[model samples]
Target: MSVLLEFTIRSDQFKLGHVLSGSGDMRFELERIVPTGGHTMPFVWVSTERDPNEDLPRFEANMRESDSVQELLALDRVDDGGLYRIEWEGQPEGLIKGLAEAEATVLEAFGDRNWTFRVRFMDHERLTNFHNYLTDHDISVHIIRTYTFTEEGARRRDFGLTNEQREALVLALQRGYFDTPSEVTLDELAEELGITKQAISDRIRRGNEKMLRPLLLSSAAR
Candidate 1:
């Protein structure tokens, strides 16, 4: 059976983490990683609460300084943020490396003060191997949760939702916003959640898509 696993690790301990930690308030989101002959290239999206132009140069310089980073290329600006391509010079570290070695798929990853990763393994043995690899490296790995990858399980496995998204969804459901009669409006849901109506709407829309993609694809095949 396939397994979906979630774990968190501090930023100070890993190479990419070290590179990202230099830019205070900047958040890194891993988009994709491709393993080359003896290296891996990671495409990352970076955003900050402040202006990107104010912090992007410094962040690029930080990436250049890291020995593991062979080359750093600024891909483009994404909305209010920036996208980057890094030529990783050496073997990756932490869970990223472990997952790569095990041939597991990293479904999602995001970072701030700490990074959270969602990884999928083919079976229990592969998952165990990944856990053992982390232990051997003396890297602390906390299992946030684990579940068999199923259509239903996808909805509950976090799906890249922030705490706010989860709360908004739960509150909306409890208040009957999803019902035909619709007991609550977006304004009411936002007021109860203490966020803007637009914010709540975006959260619900994105969260729904993320959780439903798996089921949608499965149904399309049949």
Candidate 2:
């Protein structure tokens, strides 16, 4: 049985750590991955609460200096977003290493202050092995929750939506929130989920992005 695991990692211990420091209001959203010679080039979308013109150069420079970052290849400005292609020096203590060792698949990975990743394991044993690997490296692993994956839910997860995002999307659809004549308001959805209005909105946005990205990629490929 496939299992889903949600966990957090300190930003400093992972990629883009040097570019983001002190938990400033910035976010790194993983866009795509390209396998290079012996490294992986991750194209990331970076957003900040401050001015991009002033901050992106600093971010690029920091990436070049970070020990985990092997090469800062490209940095492009896309509207209000900063896009980056970085050759990441593999970190043994990182989630990717542990997941690879355990033969697990990474579903979703995003966060600013700290990264929250949703990983899928083929079985409980693989999950246990992943946990042990991280701990053996002295990496503090924070397990949020683990649950069995449903076939229907797994199809919807191809876009990498987290559990919270998936719940919000399903609830909104069931409540006719996306209908022509909307059945529920943001505030109403927020109350129903016991979260703030902004929180619900953010979840929906992220969920939609995750759900649509795959479709867009396939279209471009063909």
| TM-score per candidate | 0.74, 0.64
Off by over 4 Å in 1: 151-160, 165-222
Off by over 4 Å in 2: 13-19, 22-24, 32-40, 75-77, 89-93, 151-207, 213-222
Per-residue error (Å), model 2, residue 76? 5.6
Error of model 1, residue 177, in angstroms:
16
Q: Per-residue lDDT for 13-116 in model 2, tens only?
A: 65454345633566777665555464556677776545666667777777777776777765676434467787766743365556666877666667786787
Clashes of each: 0, 0
Name the top lDDT candidate: 1
At residue 190, give the lDDT of candidate 1: 79
lDDT of 1 by residue, 16-38 (tens): 77677777777788877777786
